[model samples]
Target chain A: MEVTTHSAADETQVWGGGNKPLNASYGKMMMWFFIVSDALTFSAFLVSYGFSRFKFIDSWPIADQVFTHFPFLHGVDAPMYYVALMTFILIFSSVTMVLAVDAGHHMQKAKVTFYMLLTIIGGAIFVGSQAWEWSNFIRGEYGAVETKGGQILQFVDAQTGKRASIRDFATSIASERTTHQSSNGIWYQDEKALTTVTLAEVKAGFEANPNLVIRTQQLNENDQKIDLSRAASLEKIEEAQLVVEGANLIRNEYGNRLFADFFFFITGFHGFHVFSGVVINVIIFFNVILGTYERRGHYEMVEKVGLYWHFVDLVWVFVFTFFYLV
Target chain B: MAADAHKLEIFRGLLKFKSNVQKIWGVLIFLSIVTTFEVALGIIRPEFLLQDFLSMKLLNWIFILLTIVKAYYIAWDFMHIRDERSGLKNAIVLPLIILIPYLAFILILEADYIFEVMRNGIVSWNF
Candidate 1:
């Protein structure tokens, strides 16, 4: 390949006196610029996450409670372990990618191929782990009862912080069904069906089950959990609301609605990036194995991809810290 | 010529950082320690520390500080930013540093306003 430098005045000048201190190639410079722009995009998402979190500061569902599921080990209240593992996988992949780039520098084709393969495996594992997390999130564990005031009242065992499900609290109310699917007399299927259990049904059930108690929206002065007083005024206030069944974007079994939204948006966005990154990596991997770079007498393409892989890993670090840790 | 060859060997040794194997292991160990610290802070949530800080909880502040440290190491060592020129590093990072915080501050302030409206307003706005 020919290396040429145009005069500083030239629009497409590859090198200039101002750029003398840093002797990086045009491609590397562009990659840095791309990374900066991408970082900003991620920052915007994270900042929005922070904003939402602050908006629902008092009632935001605790991260540990929301993401409590561990794969295979059902009912285990493992928090952040899966995400930590995912972080390790991505970071390890980044290490392998860097190693591959280093091997490329030394013209060690076999070593480069080996490290690259390992990197690909790591990426696949991280992506799989992410999918598992999404499944767990989408299929919520302990369902809650949403009030008319848009507050979720989740049942928790007073002794254990583990969430108490509706199954534990309320028996399913049996309702008679019509023979054919009709619109006028029966509720239309096309239109969204109202919740099966009204607040009245739930209240009656609660009254029947004296053991079952209410968890309120307001936190105590000390920010500790406050059990609802069986005051007549409170009972009247609670009776006026609705009882939502399933978890939607706006609401979840966990008291906080924003929790589900953030989980979906952040993880979904990151997952999409990982999917695209894998596709790009696959293309580059195939090209590497095919000796494209060897023919070109430069392995800078591998380095460029490695940069992207590292950036993905970098983003995960922040996500893990913000979403899982604090 | 002999001196030049010796110098080249020394340069290679420096690049290798005694052993690339040892360095990789060291980085992994360091990362684990940082993560452990973060988890420990979260689990423990020391009362004294909580009482001392306003808005900035000790656990949260620790997580943020550790996160910044991790980001620095990842950028400088893993991404080879430390090997790059100061000018290149500043050019890439400074804009993001400036814009991101500014955007966060404005958005968070707006979210605060929304929160106040939701809390105090007579009329209801669906969250």
Candidate 2:
């Protein structure tokens, strides 16, 4: 037979000086440590975002203009509303998660189950909203001419703050390029055909519609927008291809490319965390339902998983503030 | 026995919030208000404030401040760090606090250098 002896110091060391009567376990402590480390990792990402913003201080894309798209509102200007809703959903989930944890403390199994289900629903909704945002971003809105200099000059209305596209003002050209989709041409299956509407066609269209005005890449000395006053000058510049409306990197009809990049990197990362968190929570949830901890006469497993769920919620709070709110 | 009584009193005090639901909701509502304020300032950016602040724009500063406030609440309340032991809390948080700012400062300084190079370098690289 094995014999063991324990002292008061050992009891205190194992149980946190008896101050915490909640009877948390080693797994819970480790989870807290993991959360802190993960939080630091997220902080690094957000801080890098800030660094980049400072780098492009003068020409950074406006967040409102970039993230203005809302579901079922085709071409309607709605800014920050969708993201705000996502934030609310995540926060609501966090609340449900805490309620579940509180119920766990009291060993109310049914209440824990209900709150956990609510949390899962919230996570699903948030992930779906993110997917919608991604699809809209990838499917760009207005096409523009890419410059050899790699600089983008977007079309803007002088009278209104709305964006304009080539299709809005220009008609398609009769002339077509010689390149075909067959083996002879520069091709990799030719997934999509290039735009048939040439600059010449646009010029003709502009001439036909005198109400339309053209804005170019070049700015005057005062850093203000300049438009072509003379039809002849416009025609000449159109022929040379020197005054084509440039592509928009910031506040385009689709959205800002930087916004897409940040969204994918930051929120995608957070989403991955949430996904893993759900997987872990599901495992523990099943265990709780099966009464594994009940067999052992303790529910510490629930507390451990609860800590992790709360950590995931905490990270979302910061992401909401920096990405959506700020 | 006396020590046990003291620890119980401390535990009771920690759990003295009206309810877990109420506490969580209170934090969420506060966070929402702060976010709304940030968005409002961003949209209705007043002219006088922008003109006054030279080094850092008032709008940008406000965003940064609000962000910090949000971070603090998230860490303290949501993560339950406020209820943790002082030693454990410092062991985790203090290092992160020092290191994050240090890393941010270095990265910002480098970014500024790159900006200067782009602005004044002999070979023109237009943004």
Instruction: Using DockQ, give the best candidate's number.
Output: 1
Q: Please give the range of 10 consecutive residues that has the lowest summed lDDT in model 2 chain A.
A: A246-255
Candidate 1, A65-183: lDDT as tens digits: 66777778888878877777788788888888878877777667788788888988999998999888877776667555666667777555545544566555555676664334455
Q: Every model's DockQ, to 2 decimals?
A: 0.44, 0.38
DockQ of 1: 0.44
A272 Cα displacement, candidate 2 (Å): 1.8
The digit string of per-residue lDDT tens for model 2 on A1-326 reads 88888898887787765465433346766787787788789889988877776665444555565577899998987777888778778777776776776676667788877887888788788878887876766454444443334333444454664556666766766664753665765656553344445656655665665544544444453223445544643443343332233122332332223544666788889888878777777776777788776677666676667667767766776676667555
Q: Ten-residue segment with the worst summed lDDT in candidate 1 chain A? A: A231-240
Off by over 4 Å in 2: A1-24, A174-259, A296-298, A324-326, B1-16, B48-54
True contacts kept of 1: 0.58
Judge candidate 2 at residue A217 and give its lDDT. 40
Compared with the true structure, all predictions reach lDDT values of: 0.71, 0.63
lDDT by residue for model 2 (B40-96), tens: 776667675564354566666677777777767666665556656777678768888
